[model samples]
Target: MKGSDPKPQSYEQLPLQFQLYDCSAGQSDCSQCRAVPEEYGCVWCSGTCVYNQSCTSVPADTCPPPQITQVSERCSVLSSSQMTCPTPAVTPEVKVKGVWFQLDNVRVHYETIKGKSFTYYPNPEFFPLNREAPDAPYRFKPGGVIAVEGQHLTRAISRQEVKARLGDRECEVKTLDNTHLYCEPPEIQPLSVDDRSELPCLKVFMGNLEVELGRVQYDSDSLSVVPLAAQISLAAGAAVIILSVLVVILMYRRKSKQALRDYKKVLLQLETLEINVGDQCRKEFTVASFPPF
Candidate 1:
């Protein structure tokens, strides 16, 4: 990195000076050169005192913290209490009963085969995952950010290393963390019945490794979006049904208890009347005994 004919004279051209090192200006200090923070895309060459950076090998052993170089939409991450939600970090996880599964996070009811597992190796590299949720199908907004999650990923891999595609449309993907990659999908074309082309593939590639996440199914028909009012009405209907069932059960129990109480009261009255009749018979029998005496 050191040569006499170095870079521009912009206070950056200086040679490494030692005890006997003397420049044309008889200077032996390199402090002024080391303070420049690479402001002009070039910093002080490590071993040399010149600012026209000639150090080609960057020390990979030490790395600075990562920073977001683009704008991002916000996402909530499940974290311990008091931790804040990360901005634009979106890798959804699935919760089943008391256990958590590292599967596609689609908000819908589904049943999976217990203890099922499968493996995939990236073929020529790219696997983009698409999960279908039940209820009313939500249409994808073109240019909206979509999150793809993977296991055992690391920050060492840069966003440039991964490539994502929806069908043939290239999705600009950005890595947010070890587990999530965000992509902006292009406008999608719905499939038609007459379309004989193979279903469009959603894949992410890392060099030559490719994982087949799934296939996209487009249709000429569109799903009807359920409005907020209809959803509220459905919830109210369910509540009404549950309340009616509880009321009927309470009424049945009350009727049974009333009948039991009435039967017990009648039995007590009949016992009292039988005792009175026995007393009257005893009085008549006593009179006959007196005449014999």
Candidate 2:
């Protein structure tokens, strides 16, 4: 057994082989944790990464993210002297722990009611909304429900505080519980599996509580007509407007031409009346010269 070392190497200084397993610490979600090679001795357990041997509760050589109840807390009282918010007078998780993180747009400080949780809080100076957080793989299309599973999900449902978004579009939340949240994305432009374009990551928020759910992926089966339909409607509207304007201009031109004809007809009649009156006056005013002859 060794007690102390006069010099120790930093983690970066470790050998390439030793560095392989240490990379597991960077994984924040279950899928990523599980993706780490098992030979690394890393196992995803209870929403955290640990050596497979450390997770004695699960089956031997097994790692799984256990199903645990999730909740968000809002405490009305704060102790300025203690610089801490008192835990609500509610049922707390049995093995309670807390982690500070900035998940997407919202700053988060979640108490893990279960096991060891990593802290990912942002330093306000370097914080930009949803910039650095990794995303989980979530396949979805408009009108289809996407389920969000995590801690404190039930609390969100009961409080009617759950909201979700993909990119800038809102995802209408349908139902939620402790371990799962069901939401439907808004209609959008068509996307296909073969299309190598990028879309926004999934984000869930409730007031100050925020969580980055994952990233959306399109598949062959998924397609949206909203954008195409909108374009068609806009084109139709423009055509109708143009037709109406043309009709109005044609009617105005016709009325102007009719008025010009009417004016010319009245002037001609006046000229004829003047000519007849002058002739009658001349005959009346003529002397008896013609009679003398």
Candidate 3:
């Protein structure tokens, strides 16, 4: 009862006989689709068909380009130039002292090892006893200055441009220039008091980039200082060994003397018992001798 001639279908259908037109063919006036210029975009409209869409077109300059006023920091275009193009890219190389070098190849001349000392042994080379005051602190010290070489280091105009690091720790840059950079090594906390790990090589940095100047190692002949505590421990160990030996010897001598005393006491008891038995035997044999006398 509710069925009305099942409402006529409303699905989209294409005409059986139709010709396809190239929308991008740039046809200005065509029977199928005509391209028309608009203020914002080029549009194609079909008067006969319901199909219509935006069309691509080469924009014609109705007015001249904007005038160049202030100079751009990157590119400076000349007034006579027709086409506006970008400026050339920045080169990676920098010039210094007539020599050209890649920014990464910049070298920092610095003396890495001012002095080094061992935790136990002290060497005059690392800590010259003659050069230091008589009351100078123990040979083992924490930090020292790193003297940079090269005259070009002075070229760095500001401290912000130059930076330095030792291993993962950033060091304080004292003096910096094109030729030299003076820096104090970071105060590193070793895992243990006897830590003898090699000092990390000094890294000279320019802003965020790391400079590849090769690794710097400490001179092996430098002063090698040892901790005073380690020396004292060695002396204490020797004293303990000597004391143990003396104690063992004294104990052995004491045992020997006690054994000699015991042996002498046993001999004396035996002699006394023998004398008492002789007296008792004489008493027993001399019975009833009064009558005979």
Note the Cα lDDT for every prediction shown. Answer: 0.52, 0.59, 0.48
> Number of clashes in every candidate structure?
15, 7, 22
Error of 2 at 19 (Å): 34
TM-score winner: 2
lDDT of 2 by residue, 91-209 (tens): 32233354444445976555543355633322111112323444434555555677665564554235366577776677778886666667777656333223333656667765555
* CA RMSD (A), model 1: 24.3
Model 2 CA deviation exceeding 4 Å by range: 1-136, 156-159, 189-197, 224-293
Sort by TM-score, top down from the best: 2, 1, 3
TM-score of each: 0.29, 0.30, 0.26
Q: What is the lDDT of residue 110 in candidate 2?
A: 55
Top of the candidates by lDDT: 2
